[model samples]
Target: MILALYNRQLVEKRSDEAIFNELKERSNYIENDIQSKLLEKNKISLTNIFELTGKDLGISFTIYDNTLQIFNSMDQYYKAGIFAERINPQVYYNLNYLSFREYTIKENIEEYVFNSFYKKISVDNKNYILAVNDAFNKVRLTFSTSDLDVLLFGIYLLAALIIILISTFLADKISSPIRRLTKATMSVAQGDLNVSLDNQEKGELKDLLDGFNLMTNELKRNQSELAELEREAAWKEMAKQVAHEIKNPLTPMKLSIQQLIAAFRDKNKRFDEIFEKVSPTILNQIESLNSIASEFSRFAKMPSYKIEEVDLANVATDVINLFTDEAVDIQLEINDQLPKISADNSQVRRLLINLIRNSIQAGASKIKLLINHENNFCNLVIEDNGKGIAPEITDKIFEQNFTTKTSGMGLGLKLAKRFLDGIGGDIQLIESSKPGATFKVTFPISQKNSFI
Candidate 1:
């Protein structure tokens, strides 16, 4: 558009210097001819010469000698016609000097502008102003831009096409990396530490893509190190707990057996009575030792999940039924139509039992289980009226081997969380307004459950 405007501006505003040059060249060519004719004392008429060169006033005419008897016309009364069409008389004013002027002529009551050049020439030693005139209509007609519209349209079309092609190419290159980054981020958020991106970009984006790959690698490495540290800590803790529990049962069993051996050696009359008493204590201690071993074994190697469509309401009811004879009143409320979730029935039961057992253990007299369906999820809210968890130790509830209880390894909630994660489910402790801990568990309504 700018180029077109510049071209139009340059063409329309042609300078007077350019017009004067054309007029000067035309007049100079005729100046020598006019002088030669005058030296030969021949009568000069421009009509025959102009007729050969052009057809219109082509406005090329010479007013020589200032007699102003200017033209030779084939028509008989040409002088009268010259008077009818007006020409500026200023052509004769600066008769002895070479000069340039613009003048208007009236032909058929319409005004036409003409450019004139006046040259002083020596013809027979008399000063003659040879005047040359150029018509404005002639210049406008010659340099008019007729096909500028088509030219500008083509330029704009080409510009738009180039812009679209370049933009599409750039968008394709940029979007591929963005999509990969988005998917990789989601994987990391879901605890998948194996996500990484292929760096296939250039320039600043290449740096960005490569940086994302590096970040994921660092995250994966950090996660592995963290898991290793946690395993070491867990082993140390488990060893201490096992040693402590085994020592408890072993000390009592050893004392009871020593008493039985001493009684048998002495042949005491009440030795049978001592043996009976010692045998019961020894059996009970053995049972306690077995229970501790079983608990630790369950924690060390959790049962594999068997994914199946399970009715959560039924499972909750069954778990609640087992506690029917207890002092606590376990109330169940269905807020909406419950949806079956894809999960292991046994794990779901265990998870619910652990939460309810914790509530009962905490002295909850009234326990409430409200199950509902919320977009794409089935949520079970277990709220109780017991002594709530202490504020200081609340964060450690779901951590393995962490517990405020005096007995049992605190594997219940941790294993529950691990199971839920396996089936694309989740459990959270809601900050309660009442006096007991509230656990809200969410089960995804639709899941392609896959886990190790």
Candidate 2:
């Protein structure tokens, strides 16, 4: 019984596949015929195919200008009726057997020949059409209604059983690998990088699984590298601050030692000469101490912000005015319609001052401060005509106490950057031209509080 059921299901599947294949071939044939007819010099109408060819050949067919409608009719039992109408309402054909004249179709026009009747033709009740394929053309001598009922009932039950079995088999075949893959993915997500899913049965799923595993491994490696990079950046920032803080005190100490050596060499210089030398050195040291104290104080203090809408162009004008009398020429290329930004006025002023000073020190003859807006952020670009910073040290320039100058505390740019950060702004040394460095600062549109 099981074997029979399996066979029934297999047969039903084969029949379905065959039906689809036949319909596809028929559609292709119709398309080719239509194209051929179009190429012919004669006036060829597809409608005539039904009237002339189908009727003459005793084959049921309906021709329509639309391919889909014609194909749909062929799959339905309505093809013959539609064919009759298309050909002519009077033309009709019927299939008859030798012994039993079971069904009769009456026609107004005699367009069909008796055409030796076959007794064992297979009928497809699903489509309400006869399968005229060469493999199933054997004519049945007779059909008994009782026998037919029994045969149909058993065939239907068997086909149902077969389909259930095939479905179960396919489900298991497809789901087993998928279940395995899901488990492996869960393990990976839970931090198990060593999990393996090497199902190499050679199909699309296998390739996808392989690629997924490869991607996971690459991501893991990148994550490790990123962690290392972050650690390095933190250390660099810390070292910068420490060096700058230490150098402040060290500069004055060096000057004091130089004065002591000068006093030792001049015996006749008298108390005034020695006192004068020591006094200037002491004052220098005190100044250095003050600078160091102030810088550290600023670093340690948390700023209070007072954010307000301020025009950037006016701010640039004020900052540039500080260097007006200097030998260097400063230019403001502020956008005429630059938007007012919600930022701390004091912090913006300090940031601009530091940046401008850096530009002047960088040997810029003409510093251009360009203000603009981009992607909802306010952009400030400071360009100089001084010697540009070396490409190698560009990234480290923001570090505390890291400077290329012989004088002054190196905390100017670093403090400016931190101040900007406090106000939810970012600063970057964008590029340097032949003259000097270009620094770009971006401030977010929405500032929660003003900078103090």
Candidate 3:
């Protein structure tokens, strides 16, 4: 509005020369009036024209003719009347000739200058030019950019925090079940065949868990079937042994009775002597048959165990004392500091007695019993310097009715192994080579109730 008013006033004049004369006259009048006021206040200079224009209109102004006057809002004043050629001769010429150009200007303020918008206005007949500027626009733009940067930073920070929280929650949810499955798999590998997993998860993991549970159940069922088949085979083998033992004595008894009948028929004088010999033979064979029957009965009807905490070394010592009259040399090596094991007293004693009887029957001259603690177990090692079991039949040594002895039932070692198994203990043939046989019995330190 101010620029339009000034342009109209300048355009109403007659020519370019008249326009310049009129502007100079107005400038002198304003300067003289300001100087008159300063004189009254004992001042000698004219008041700053830029300060007056900015206070009234919030802008800076400049005028160019043959001379130049530049004023700014900062209360600066510059004049280059005829000496303008000494200041920047090309700059004054461009400002005078470029009457319609409007562009940005850079001028020093304090120690630096910033860009500000300016427009050039032509007076009547292109005799003079006026420049108008607004410098504070750049200050508003700087403040706006700073505020935008702060807002963008806050938004990015919030997004990153939210992503971290979500990632943590998802990781826990996914890994927790996998950890449980890993623990369950370890339990299965360690021989807990009954271990299984829950099928409570969703998607592919749920299918995998269900499949694992089914596999465990199938494994358990297969194991049970195999155990049943082994039991049947053992029973059939025992029956065959019984038949063979009974046939051995029956054949000799039949021969002796037939010879006595023949002698009686002949009516010889030595018939009485032959009858006496035959009578004792028949009696001995009957006793042998009775012994076989008794052994089978005992094997078939194993006694139930009475579980209790007992010192295995003491039990071994008692078994050793029982064989004092025997010709074989028996020695006991025991660690007295060993922890008490949970077992039935009578069963342990019987198990030791059977092993010792086996060594004596095998023609062992020396037997050693070692008792100690190792790896959370109580170990009882029985080593014998006897004719070791043949490699061909080593695996069958503990099978029911399987024996290498001439006048013995094979139930001894089988019954011993069964007894140990019933009490949560295990027996293994550590070595069975010539000149010696070693057997190891291990029992867990802590026992729970178990039965066969």
lDDT of each: 0.70, 0.59, 0.65
Highest lDDT model number:
1
| TM-score winner | 1
Clashes of each: 0, 18, 0
Q: Which 10-residue window in model 3 sums to the lowest lDDT?
A: 79-88
lDDT tens readout by residue for model 1, 393-432: 7788889989877755466789888888877789998875
Worst 10 residues of 1 by lDDT: 100-109
Q: What C-alpha lDDT, on a 0 to 100 scale, does residue 29 get in candidate 3? A: 43
lDDT of 3 by residue, 1-452 (tens): 35444544454332333433433343444334434444464433223543553454443445445454444334333332322212234444555566434333444457764343333433223433343332332222222334544655676678779889999988877886677677656545544454446567899889878888888778767866786798799799999999999999999899999999999899978899998888999999999999999999988767577777787877787667655545679999886588888777666776777787677767799999989898778999999998988899989988988988653446667977887787768999999878889999887675554443
lDDT of 1 at 78: 44
Q: Evaluate model 1: give its TM-score.
A: 0.47
Off by over 4 Å in 3: 1-47, 55-69, 72-101, 104-115, 121-143, 257-452
Report the error of model 3 at residue 438, Å.
37
